[model samples]
Target chain A: MSLASLTKDWAATSYGFLDASAKRELRRKMLKAIAVPGCQMPYASREVPMARGWGTGGLQVTLTLVNPASTVKVIDQGADDGVNAASIRRFISRVSGAAETWDTLSASIVQSRHRVPEEVMREDQILVLQVPNPEPLRGVEPNMSIARQMHADADYGKLWLTLYEQIVRKGRIMQGAAYPSMVNGRHVMTPSPIPRWDVPKLNMAKHLTFLSAGREKRLFAVPPFTRVEPLVFSDRPYQVEEHAHLTCRRSGLSGYFMNEIPQDNGGSTFEVSDSNLGIKAIQKAEGAPTEIGETWYRDGEYSA
Target chain B: MLTVAPPDAIELRCNSTFQALMWALSRPGDARVMPEAGLAGIAETLVDLECTVFADTPDLREAVSASGALVTGDVSRADHVFLSSLENAADQIVQLRCGSPLYPDDGATLIVAARHAGQRLRLSGPGIEEPTEISLDAPPAFWAMRAMLCAYPEGFDCFFVDAGSVIGIPRSTKVEVL
Candidate 1:
């Protein structure tokens, strides 16, 4: 290898494509998130190789925090190899030689979609959620400025009235997925579009839960041991509707919130939301279903 | 240390691969099958990806080597670098790009021809309603460099190809994990 040739090769190497100025600002936002403790901070969102609502926020958080020593785990609903999750896995491995794992237990950082894992997350574990739509009042009021004011003054009478009106009109809350909740009794944040069943599970916890919306460029957090109460009234109390017919055949459990399976026929059919995935744990003690049900379409009916 | 574009900088060339991935993961257990022919039906099957790796490049030179193998070119502009010192470019692959932390979904991918592409840690994340499928080799840690990446979005994303089959994990995704 000639000296001249070596010099020429060095000149061609572009170490990083990301602009230096942009990186600095994002780092500042990240630092603010860590310093305030459970505060939602605005940062410059990047257009990743991936799109918005597709774990882009989580990808940004992971990328910003990535060090040579970290182990990465990406999960959507639980299984790691889902297309979105898998694609993220591919990108991280490319930028760095950091290790990857399917096991959520050992994972230092876990990026999730709708459902948080069934297992209890630790205080040290970091949970990054890719929020499709972050505003709780978006569906109710469709105005961002009003919702911000409502949170600022702790005015949630309207949300209560909306739910109360639903009961008075439809006999129940009738909300399917992406049920809303208040974080720290202040920020009325949307906990992604998860099933109503999982909403109860989000009580005070130890882990650091982050919500990121790449398209909206919004980032928020829920720190450890904070109050997370689902707003409900004394009479109605917030009941999570059930799957009328479908149940986890493997686990022999029924009435879980169910997503639908689009049959060849025009109209779709409904099935268990946590279907085959939830069955894995209790199934062995019970047994694997001689049958499995397929369900869901991307970005549909979470907040409705 | 990488610089980012203006929050709305020069429009970023979208990563077609990521869009295609959102589709795949959004509807788990369903394979968005693609054509095997090299760059043949890429447009039809690859609704969100680009075929930019044409033969007309200044530094790229793909050829068969004496070791009856291949090598990933100097790992620079090649963000999604693929490596397999064992096979010809025409033959099967052993490793590919997967993004790492700071860019987990941006690392190189690997397609080790291991006998099995299903084993190791379990994973789960968004874009999955139920248990999605995975095609990985046994004891992902056995790959040493591969297993260590489990921390996330900070490690390399990978796909294991064996016996004409493939399984993927992007940087933002989580493995089913035990």
Candidate 2:
């Protein structure tokens, strides 16, 4: 083959901020990740402008999937206006020319950290979660090689033991976020530090979820309709963060997950953690034309 | 302000092709339309110098080689295998790489040319909300062979291409002949 055939014309920067070969590599790994649901697949984890731990994995996946036609949304800790979320959203839109949106219903791809949207995601939408640690066995087993062997053997007894110990000591399961969940009845995965309330939203849901850890250089997926059962005992049922009775002080919306603001008067007030949902509710109350999609929870109950 | 670089023709094609392939694999048994009507677009979208591909047809082999991938005659060594047809592929199917449990990503991705109509098969697994039935040109023997070879996380994934349409059945999918 001629040398000219091997090379392409020079350009300042590659489209979507990632070279074609990088995207191709990610595509291969992503397909494999989906093929074996919740099984971690190792990738090159190429460097981007941002640091490795701060949503780099999600950014890479987003960049690979983004195009001019895509509408992108980025959220940090369930808030679209967080510094990290806003920066990522703007960066993706700036590099790929994709439209940015805060509303979950309108986004084609949502790159999130620590939370799934309160609204039910459709089949067409993809959720890319920024994972700080993808391994569910890390807390119990420090060594990764043995941990991988345990995963191969589907041995998750230590995780259950830890939960049992917590129950014996605290009288309840103390695990708050990033609960270890069994996917497709085989692999146990950390759903990426999302709250207990949000974890149920992933169980047999319509959307495809990708949990990627850039620093760890691993990625996994939970395909639509896949079972994501949180580890719980037979006697004690799984408990969400008791935010069902809490109400958002600003929007007057209640029954969703809330963020508590500590007051100097030895009390705390609650606001909806999903900032866009509160904004939409306030706008609708103000008589502005706004559309709020159906949520997964209703009347402080996990309905969907 | 810096002006964003627009996507080139190849970028657009690969993007759309991957989108179709991604959604197809995400929801197994669903037919997704591709931008182009052949295996060539898929090769361009997935394989590169990092991959070893096995293509049954000489035309597809040449196309894969042009993309700088190591085109191989041995199916077991290939991470991606493209078959123009699956008429008498018993031996090849047996030799297809189903990766080890430790590193399941090493499993091969089998892409074959097959019609979307024929014998009905039921698919149920991670992707399917309910057990869905669809017709494919592959024989029942093929499904039986697949069931014998695949052992969940350690089996190969597949893509069946027909003109501009493609359907993906991942290793996680359980396919039953009707």
Instruction: Using TM-score, give the best candidate's number.
Output: 2
Top model number, lDDT: 2
Instruction: Give the alpha carbon lDDT tens digit for every residue of B1-178 in model 1.
Output: 4232222211111122222222333222223432231221221122111111211122222321111123334442232333332234322222334333222223433322333335545444432334555544445333444445444323443333333333444333445434
For candidate 2, state the interface root-mean-square deviation in angstroms to 1 decimal.
Answer: 0.7
> How many clashing pairs does model 1 include?
121
lDDT of 2: 0.94
Off by over 4 Å in 1: A1-24, A30-40, A241-247, A250-304, B1-178
Worst 10 residues of 1 chain B by lDDT: B7-16
Q: What TM-score is obtained for chain B in each of the predicted models?
A: 0.44, 0.98
TM-score per candidate, chains pooled:
0.51, 0.99
Question: Which one is best on DockQ?
Answer: 2
